[model samples]
Target: MRALFNDRGRAALDAAQDFCTTDALAYGPLRSEDLTADGSSLGELMTGPVLGPLTVANTVGFTAPVAPVMIVHGVHDASVEIEQSRLLAQRWRAAGAVDITVREFDFGTELVPEFDHTATNVAAYPEVIGWIDRLVARA
Candidate 1:
């Protein structure tokens, strides 16, 4: 997901924090495996507003861990505005996210150069996998 949607993510988090609740959309860096169980339903839905339901993690209330997050984005992403990730990184940090990494790829000879929304998935796979592995190890 784009994380923060027109500041709604921020608003939701703020409301929860003020109300002493935990039902807001908890920011997370989703990986492919995380969506396999949905049979690619999420794949089709992510580009649209259908994932709105996922904004609430648990209806009954559960405290999602403020896990370390890393947003690997292509500066030239066609589907999502780079600003969304930037604002999300900022908001998540302000909300007490201890570890937030925004690794961006521009149009140079750097990692994932000539980046695009879908290209990032293949170009940055190794780095993304490593980050996930590290997080899992910590867990």
Candidate 2:
């Protein structure tokens, strides 16, 4: 998360941006199925020797103190489940973060109408702007 990069805590951010973020790495090694589904070459690289070993939970854990985080994810996300955001929020709380929030959106196909894994930034702009205004005012 961008919040983790701030050295001066919440004051360092005018606002924070978060899209579909995964709380935990998916189980097991990368499979050909993942590549075909996502069409990402990066997925293959992530499973390679360089990034594969670093993909573990412990390696991906977030613990730094920073600005308030506003996470937005689609409820029916196929790439990363919404539960991952929930779990990440839990982890942030367990680690002593109090200014984190998660917002779920609905968008998808007819069969699974809420299954949108990718949403445009415009869809969340208003909320993001409001969040930034509030945080900036507080700062």
Candidate 3:
């Protein structure tokens, strides 16, 4: 993931900002501390004598997009707060993007019957696929 912050990967990210008729689907998306959240695996491992890349992969500074995006997260996820998704949506809307969707779910809402960081991806697949189908139809 650190490679995403390098010169070559940065160029790709810069180009993604100009999305044209594309769709984004994020499930239980976790944010790094740098992206204005509480948890970070890198932070935990990057201790003394284990230096690493300074740049982290996150959407903290991403600007508004030309295409629509959907972010799904669990309401009671212990590892990552749903607030992170809200913050991203707020930031994108503040930048003038209006099509960002942040979907939140609770336990017993799907086949898995539990909604957490890992559970969201599996439980939400049925609805998520339909969303992708709709997005494809629009395109």
Candidate 4:
């Protein structure tokens, strides 16, 4: 039982590392401590690290033709807040790019009940696929 728990702990750590690495890769190095410190709001932290890339990504509108942009975001995500994706969706809509969908889930972090940092996104994959299907079928 101890071994099983150990393995799970390691897996969770690995997932977190991967998540951080991916973010840095996309948006560049972040003052991770500042973002995680007490009294630091997620929205404030995201203003630079996340929103900067989003602005660039949406500058010319989605070139793929209303390709049913589906953002599977964890509502309680600590690394990246749902508001980031929510803002993205809103920008996409403003760009006249219809058929964008943002889905939220409750599984990501195990240690922090409020932070869903784990990759339990598979739980919402089916519904996300259906959303994409409907968007694709639209005129």
Compute each candidate's TM-score over C-alphas: 0.46, 0.54, 0.53, 0.47
Using lDDT as the yardstick, the better of models 2 and 3 is: 3
Residue-wise C-alpha lDDT for candidate 1, range 18-126, written one tens digit per residue: 6521232243343443433343444455444556566544222133227776788878775577887887777676666778777887653346433346676667788
Query: By the TM-score metric, which is better: model 2 or model 4?
Result: 2
Instruction: Write out the backbone clash pairs for model 3.
Output: none
List ranges where model 4 is wrong by over 4 Å. Answer: 1-65, 112-115, 132-139
Clash totals for all candidate models: 0, 0, 0, 5
**Which scores higher on lDDT, 3 or 4?**
3
lDDT of 4 by residue, 1-139 (tens): 1122244333443556668534434444444333343434334534556555665565544443355577788877776778877877776787787767667786547665432444536577788778767766975
Question: What RMSD, rounded to one decimal, does every model reach?
Answer: 15.1, 12.8, 11.1, 11.3
lDDT against true structure, model 2: 0.58
For model 3, residues 60-105, the per-residue Cα lDDT tens digits are 6358987888888888766578898888888889999988867787
TM-score of 2: 0.54
How large an RMSD does model 2 have? 12.8
Best by lDDT: 3
Q: Where does candidate 3 have its weakest 10-residue lDDT segment?
A: 21-30
Query: Global lDDT of each model?
Result: 0.58, 0.58, 0.61, 0.58
lDDT for 51 (candidate 4): 53
Q: Alpha carbon lDDT of residue 42, candidate 1? A: 46
